[model samples]
Target: MNLSRPLDSAGGTDDSLGGSLAFGVVKSERQRVGVLAVLIVLLIAALLWSVFGPVVMQPELREKVRASLPFGIGMLTVMFLYECTSFGWLTQLIRKGYEPVYWVRVVNAVIEPLFFTAVLAFLIVFVGPLNGMAGPAPYIYFPYLALSALSLSLRLSLVSGITAAIGFNVAAFFAVHGLEATPSTAVLVSFPHYGMKGILIVLTGLAAGYVGHRLRKQLGESLKVARERDRAVSIFGQHVSPSVADRLLHQSVELTGEERQVCVMFVDIRDFSNLAAAKLPGEIVEYLNQLFGPMIQVVNDHGGIVNKFLGDGFMAVFGAPSEDLKLARNAVACAREILSSTDRLVAAGEIPPTRLGIGLHVGVAITGNVGSEQRKEYTVIGDTVNVAARIEQATKQFRAQLLVSDAVAEQCGPDVAGAVDLGLVELKGQPKPVHLYQLV
Candidate 1:
């Protein structure tokens, strides 16, 4: 049996990665809200100081305060409501029903920077052209610029940053023209001076973009790893040990498509059909669970993985998902240990008395991820696998508990020392006879 993915009602595969990405998006949105809240608090503190405290009591400013304060407060309120509501809507969309829309998120990224532009315009209208351009209003862009990095997109950050700079310079241009005399010669809004500030803002955005780009790359890799891990757990069940999973993903061992030299082992319960017929289905399942659980652990400890469980037994592999120089040897060692473990379990009365037949062979085989776009499986399939299964069946004919092909006998290290040569045995459905050795 192969691992298969469950299809959704819409005929789509589960979008685990997309769900993870949405989680990241939610975090960024929350951060943006924090940034905006901080800005509002700072603005409120500045207004309170100017209106009550002695920070700014300039004769020219006192009369203009009342007019400017209402518009400033209004702008802040609108910004707060817009962002909080948008954030709420996005959070609900992700948490409740639909997948996040890309264009909607991108639009939000574009709109956030525009708030600073509105603030700049407000400042120009309240304070004089030159004074407003030089005031803290322009500095508000800094926090907003930094917030863009949360998108983990360089292009979005750069576009948002550079666009704000141009908008600022444009507002400055129109305001400077408000002066009737020497407007062109005004040094504060001069192209050279103001252009340098604009350049600095653009540069800061570029840096933030680079940071976001790096973060995006790292997050993608982390999500991919998490998806693979969840997939493995889904296929193998909770009883499958981590050691078995680790073998498939240890350093330099990727489960990509390729041909590799592998040791294939087929294990089966001898006379399982006869034994199962006497018991209820539930009892059969319980017996199999009790018997196979520890045997699978033995396979894991010996650097082999039970690829998939058959009704009565399992097919295990060595050196496919992970490279093992001792693959043939490990497969041989693992098979012997399983035989010992089975006898112990039966004697302990943990499971009904039973017998197992195991066959091992080492040869080149095609091993990798296979299946449809929605369903994928990492498995071994080749002549070596076929021969190994055939050998397991031959065990009853030869009256042996375990058998290994000539290739396994040669490559399986010291385990071959006492292997009894069974000579050429013609396996069923095979064109030629196979040389076999009995280990038990």
Candidate 2:
């Protein structure tokens, strides 16, 4: 017997997650560029103010500011160039792929620390004492550490912290020496003070690194779970409806075997063997595709799952994964639609004219995962399923397009319109006879 499996969905969850990550990376890069642009604008404004402000309000500071102008311009130029290069690098990285590589994180860790170091060096050697603004130089470490912590890499964050601390101490030493009339006493006293500041920088780096590491670990775990859930949904969706697949992934119901009242449907193409013998393999497959495609959609639309495809046919089930009170009605409606669709296809010359026999029965059946440990299939098994198949076979003898057991017709209520009672007929392998109905 041929078993028709549910058709696979068009896209998988991996594609979805991949697209999301790509968009996120592009957004991050754009944000970085925007921030850099803003910083460059602010720096240009500051440089303009420094040059012209002293001339207007602090005439005594005018010469000093002019003396520091060249150094300020040089520092700003370096920063601008670095930011532009960093932006270019980000664009290139995104163009290649959005995966977060170790080297990229390392580069990110080093760049900010190096830039701040350059700024500190310039402040100590030129901008600070020359302009009489040296007090705030030591306080720059806080923001540097704060920004570094955002990298989400413990090693990189720690590296940035240590580099900033060393740079700060080096800048402080140079500033102290430049101010000292006598170097010996000044150097000794400055060493201990800068040494304490270095210790604080290290502690801050450690604390930030620890927190970042923990957060990154948690975020990774959450992402892993989401990916697994997406994958499960994709795979399970092939066997069941998307809504049912989602519920399965979320553990709303157990997949272990259980007996449930379900309506089983079997549809077989009549004279399929004769058609196959006359046509090429490709033509046969094309013909089947044209036939099965619409039939599957009809089943899906009426809340029936096309559980399996037998070589020349397929089996559908209703109310297995979840109970459906209207399953019998839905199955009957689905069968009607399938017959109409096949007729349309044949008339349109898309598929050769063919006859189909469908059988539906409603009863309690064992439904769930069935197979080996390595492989399993979620399906229904029991007399209801077998009886449905037998009823389908009976269609050939009776020369009827559709047949349903008394149980199915009863469950269908008023939905089985134009159905003619076939009276009591003994189905194969059954001790008692079953009343069948043929849909007009």
Candidate 3:
């Protein structure tokens, strides 16, 4: 019922479905209003013609004019009706990601017009003869029949002017020859001639529809591709860190928190300051994205929540109000995963090979909204977070790629075997010197 990004694991929900439907309804109504406006214009022209034209005119000319008006109006009406059908079907097809311009639509267009034209032809032929036989010799029943056929065909074709002219003349010729039953001085009408003309028009429509359908199909494919490309570029530009923009994009997830023990990881790229100082702002952002993409992927795969993204790094918190208790293990796994994935990225010439330092700590922390009421962030704040950052910083002194505090090492348990003593180190903002270990 819902629509979502193809990359997202969770399929869309009812809300997305509702949103799509609302947009579709609005668009359909707008089109309908436009069609109504056009019909109104036709009405105004019809009214003006009725008022200006004389009631009594030349017999031949009067017949021609009367026939012509209905022919044009009937065709226009049929065209409007079919357009509504085609437009509605096409909208649904495009929205659902299907190519609607297939052989089927062509077939429908042909069949629809033919069916409508045949109905008009039958009414004209059957009705015209009865009216003519009972009426005066100057009765314009034949012209009326010709006009009805012309209008039905012309409207169906959507090219009324020249086509209607040719058709009217042709129908008049056939009527004169086929209805020889009446005296030379009397007017006559032939149902058989109208029937034959209907068959011809239907056949012509089939051919035209087939060709038009193919052209529409090709044009639709190119148009779809171009629009998709534009959409992709727009999505990419709109992409933001899930931590910041997830609330806006996904309305389903409740953006709230409860106090709980959580594993926190603070990671920073080595020599990040020097790199930023050398590169331009745009280059720096691009470079950071290249380095951060894989690292972020590792965290997300391990079921960790990215809390905040720093300029040259990101802060990840595992096991919070919305996380599993085994968040410490997940964090350690993520760090190892990031280290492994970076090797491939370096070889691809995307990002330079650089060492990443991560500090992991697990303990009771006031993990919730922090900062002033005007602007707040969901983060972990306590000795546990501070200790994690200190241990990671210890990596520089020990000449190690990864470093863990005594608390994190304890949580890691017997699974973590290789460890080197970094001795006691004065942690900033803390009174006591904390013991650190290097993962050898």
Q: Using TM-score, rank the candidates from best to worst.
A: 2, 1, 3
Q: Distance (Å) between predicted and true CA of 328, model 3?
A: 1.0
Candidate 1, residue 267: the lDDT equals 89
- Model 3, position 374: C-alpha lDDT score: 51
What is candidate 1's lDDT per residue for 1-440, written digit by digit as tens?
A: 31111222122434766556556655665566666767777776776677677764677775566567777777777877787776676556545534344565666666766776886788678876776787777887777778778877788788878887887778778877645546655677465577778888888889888988898778878978888877876565444345444444443434466788899888899889999999999999899889888888888888887887788888999986778999988888898899999999888988888999998888999976666555555678989899999999999898788999999888865778988999999998778999999996
Candidate 2 lDDT by residue in tens digits, 1-440: 21111111112342454444443434454454446545655765765676675435365555555666677667767777776776676666556544344565566666666665675566545544423223443555665565444455578768877877787677656666545445655543455667788889877877777876776566656656787887888787766656557654554244578899999999999999998999999999888888998988898898888888899999999887778889999989899899999999989988988999999899999987666555656778999999998999999979999999999989878888778988998888987888999996
Candidate 3 wrong stretches, greater than 4 Å: 1-257, 370-376, 421-424
lDDT tens digits by residue: candidate 3, 1-440 = 23212211222432233333333333433353345435534543653364356555456544544564555456546655665665565466446533222244334424433433332343244335333233232122222222222112233233322233234334444445554465643434554454454455444543443443454455446545655655554463234334434432332234444567778888888888887888899998898888887787788788786776777777777875355766777778788788777777888878876778877777777765545545545566777777777767767776677776677678877646877767777777678887777664
Indicate the worst ten consecutive residues by lDDT in candidate 2. 2-11
Error of 1 at 356 (Å): 16
Can you give the TM-score per candidate against the true fold?
0.53, 0.60, 0.45
lDDT (CA) for every model shown? 0.76, 0.72, 0.55
Instruction: Give model 3's clash tally.
Output: 2
